[model samples]
Target: MNNNLPEKQPPEKTDWLLFPQEISRDDIEKEIKKTPIAIQKILNYYLLTDFESKYEEIHLFLKHFNENKKIPIAKINNPVIYKIIKTARSIQRQIHKLMGLLRFREIEGGYLYASFTSDFNIIGPLSLHFSRRFPEEKLIIHDTKRRKALFVEKGKLYEVVSLNTLPSDTDEESFFRQLWQRYHQNISITERENKKLQRQNIPLKFQHWLTEFKGSCALPQLDGNRENI
Candidate 1:
């Protein structure tokens, strides 16, 4: 007797709601339908060239999916597509904000050490910022979220092992951060503060980045005062 596991189905396609508002569901479907088969051929060639050594069947399946499925262009009208696009855009914005707010510190041996979560692909914009801000210092931005890092040494950028490999963890930079936080905290006045202006100054999503944001850090060491909490 032979027992075989049931075949697993492909995961559902991503929703289009998350996509840019300009790209509609009908537009997407229409584009897909109108595109020549040559596009798939080109895609197959590139995929096989890139990934065939590890997964030969990947190209075959992609080709098959391309031929078999009807991907509508205007996925914007589709609720599922809309949701996917919307979520993707939100994630992109968060990553962009994080990169913009990333603080870089110069370390020993001309090495600049900066760290952040790498949930989204924020490295590209980050490199742009560092190139503009610090033309002299070679740097690395270790993104803990994805356990990956980018090294910008002598103006060249490349991916490297995570900074978790570094000798010190958060302990390495916690002291300076605490001092900086204290200085900022001390200057704030409760009497003249405008809650609306505060919200406008720092959006709720990015409040996690603010040292004054209550309960941001779970650890007592990183957590600030709890007057509001």
Candidate 2:
């Protein structure tokens, strides 16, 4: 006779709630259904992104709503409401920035690869913009800080934890990168250079992956192995 132990399952979000040990997803869903349709849409769309502080904010909001079945309207006056709004806006801003700043390099397999680190998890939102912009192309937007990626092919999108390894840039990509750098340099006037404004617009942290700043299209190395989410 042989005995094998069952595989362990990861902890669920409800299992970690401190005050209300018996709270469940069903309870949250019921409470969410009671809110106005517009408020429900805002909560469902913006608040549920992969933000690190989301769970805590969600828990607090749910707890408050359970006691008083109302969504806070005055966000500026209410600290909790303000914090949640701020977090969502931060993610939105990052998405906007990445959409504009992301420079994709065509690699050996004719795939566009772009890698950048974002303070907030904005890959999911970014994928929608890029997929629409390049409908037929295969694109990978890697979030180096979070070790996550959004893969888009033929207008379809999916996520991967870590990419296998990015191939080197194609000859055309190299030529264009050099040409862009030269153009960027020529356009700059030393008398008109504004370090403070440049820093504010494109923070120093993001310069590494920007082709014009680095003078070349470079792929960043992925960290150690990561399990798919």
Candidate 3:
């Protein structure tokens, strides 16, 4: 071995030796400003085209906003975010609508099935009501919009079945509906004739759920149906 041994190879160089240090925000802003006009336009447009872009805009806006003091509408130019906001508002409007619109047909296998054409988020609240009311029944509400099904099976809740799955009720369900209609009709006073009060009691959209609604003859069998209880 050589006497000096080449100074023990001077320890291997590390990435930190050659790596560039982080630039100051001012320097970064200056460099970003120097970026081509077309490139800036492309970056701005990137914030416009997609949902992820909105997240990116939010991230960049929050990141740069303190020092930058102003975020150009151009930097965060997302019409999609507006669409999402509008959709969210629309969903809020439809919460009561879904509450009214959802039709749960009790089936033979101790299951409650319904098809909902709304956001999956709405199902969380809906499930709370249904599961509380029908704790014993296995419930499934499929959202056609998301192509996913929310199943409350044996008291557990989650999504299932990406593919479409249709549900069916028993033939006895029709006979039971007739009996319920008769009961409803029997309870109604023909002499009272408060059409306005009746409408207020049950809205037109919920007409389908009413067993006595002129054309809906399929009243569920109320007798043994209480077995679930």
Candidate 4:
């Protein structure tokens, strides 16, 4: 046989490029406004959706969006559309869960302090719900995972980051916690204890911060002898 080398195959072409660009918050807000109302809601929700690969997912969505001027929903089989829908659903679920599961305790300054780590950046969305409900009360919804907090005071809402500290709980808080735990235990029906169903509804991740959960009453306690402000 004649010694002959096989021809080298050309490199496979990619449909996407990897150029990194600096995008400002205002610019992004402006771009979001240019989209249809329905699409704008999706884009806003995507901002609060938390995922490890969110940046890549959003980049892909933007690429598709820029080309089509709208999501190609007719192509339901498209991976980008599927991902966007999945992310939006996840964010919605977390928001609903927190609306019920989030527990706030009264602190020294008549402030309601609730601490929880959410899979999504939900504090911003939760602020509106809580502000409407507890309009007059000062509230702090702290996101332990992101080290950020949403402060709702005097009918205004704002966010602060890298603030991991919390003030001491008031004596009334401790007393109420005991009563709450007792009420929870007294109302339980041992026969109807469906651990699987409970986990399905409340989820184990959320249970750790819920007031009705066994050890959660002890949470949100002051860290390192911090004096109450």
Candidate 5:
């Protein structure tokens, strides 16, 4: 999430009715509860979008929805609302793509490590996922673009930090990485290759960290296995 909604101020020239108060923690919590739980989820996801004006769009939609309290937000035909919904879906898509693309290799001390880049700030979501997926494992997922790393251990998300260095990969880890690449290369059918479709599925922006395309994502339900790292 962008994490700036609380600091977002109304435009100076806007009608007072539209934005009566500056955004605050109390205001957002109150507004979120006024809507259905499902819509509330969408609102949270909307904040994950990389849109430059997402806060403005969110404020606009909330104002509109308030004025039309008689109608459900889902039934409203507002452009801002539509944009919020679309962008939220896009956020989910990126998360799903990262889940499939992330490749972890065992580093020194048996810690799993994977690094990838994303335009959106998504380390929080990714941590929720891997922490649950590999509950007992100690791992790190690095968002190289943001220079942040999420650490997961004993089925719980740990501190997010700016890592200056990572554990070194051992000879065994390097061997497996090469073997995986070789297997991937040999499985390809050159005649059936479609570069355009390949690019569409795995954009160059996301390919840098994928072991297959030459890269890598999110949260899963932790089943009764939570423990301190």
Candidate 6:
């Protein structure tokens, strides 16, 4: 902690560049210069995706970007360029979906915690998002598969050294959690239930951690030619 820091408050926005320290984006832009929006999206994909041979792919993409800044990216047919572009698009979709789907709960010390697992390494972008979205509120967004967490406090973000599993939510959390769960159940039109399509919109992989699906054993299941709930 540097006591020489300014007394001003941090900004209420996040970006592609993540500084582990309390450095502001303005300070970073002074050093690295502001990256273009197109390049920033590519950087987000580079940071989020863990595809094999990624080092080679990114090196190729950056080389191409430098040489052909004026041409449309879709016209690039190099193998590495095409693969990275596709992977970037996949990462973009995962980030968009997971941001909307994460469900936070009030935990000990009044911290809000949300946990989920994903095939891609996506915790960084999600933390950047929620930190801005809930600046005053403390938050912990955990990526279960990675066994890591993003800790945010007072609108400043912290990348933790290590984290054991958090204790259960505050006792008071149960009441509101149940209320929301019940409300979700009550408004449903079971007569029009379509498990197949429902799963299409909200994949079963994400349902296990969602509150509304809790304690409900009738979740859709399939067995070849037979469907079971």
Error of 5 at 133 (Å): 0.7
Question: Which stretches of candidate 3 lie above 4 Å from their native place?
Answer: 1-84, 119-125, 162-167, 178-229
The sequence of per-residue lDDT tens digits that candidate 6 reaches over residues 1-229 is 8789878644643212232335443443342224467766665576566665455445456556667878776686667677767778878887898888899999888899898998799888889999899989999888889888889988788887787867677655665677678788989999999999989878899998798888642333333542231
Q: State in Å the error of residue 124, model 2.
A: 0.7
**What does the lDDT read for residue 90 in candidate 1?**
58
Error in Å for residue 4 of model 4:
25
lDDT by residue (tens digit), candidate 4, 1-229: 9779788654653334355555555666677788778777776788786665455555556556667654464354557667787778788888888998899998888899988888778888888899988999999989888888889987789876556567787876876676688788889999999999999998999898876786533434443544543
Instruction: For model 6, name the residue pairs that clash.
Output: none
The number of clashing residue pairs in each candidate reads 30, 0, 7, 0, 9, 0
> What is the C-alpha lDDT profile of model 1 across 38-104, one tens digit per residue?
4433232222122212122322233344554576422224443343334445555655576666666
Question: What TM-score, over all chains together, does every model reach?
Answer: 0.48, 0.73, 0.44, 0.77, 0.77, 0.73
Question: For all the candidates, what are their Cα RMSDs to the real structure?
Answer: 12.7, 12.4, 16.2, 6.8, 11.3, 15.9
Model 1 stretches with alpha carbons more than 4 Å out? 1-75, 165-179, 192-229
The models' CA-based lDDT, in order, is: 0.53, 0.72, 0.55, 0.76, 0.76, 0.73
Candidate 6 regions off by >4 Å?
Answer: 1-36, 67-70, 216-229
lDDT (tens digit, per residue) of candidate 2 on 1-229:
5578788664752324445444455665676678777546545545546655554555566555555555455433446656666666666677788789998999998789999987766677788899999999999889887788898999999887668788898766776788788788888999999999999999897889898997543433444453431
In candidate 4, the residue pairs with backbone N, CA or C atoms under 3 Å apart (3 or more residues apart, or in different chains) clash, namely none
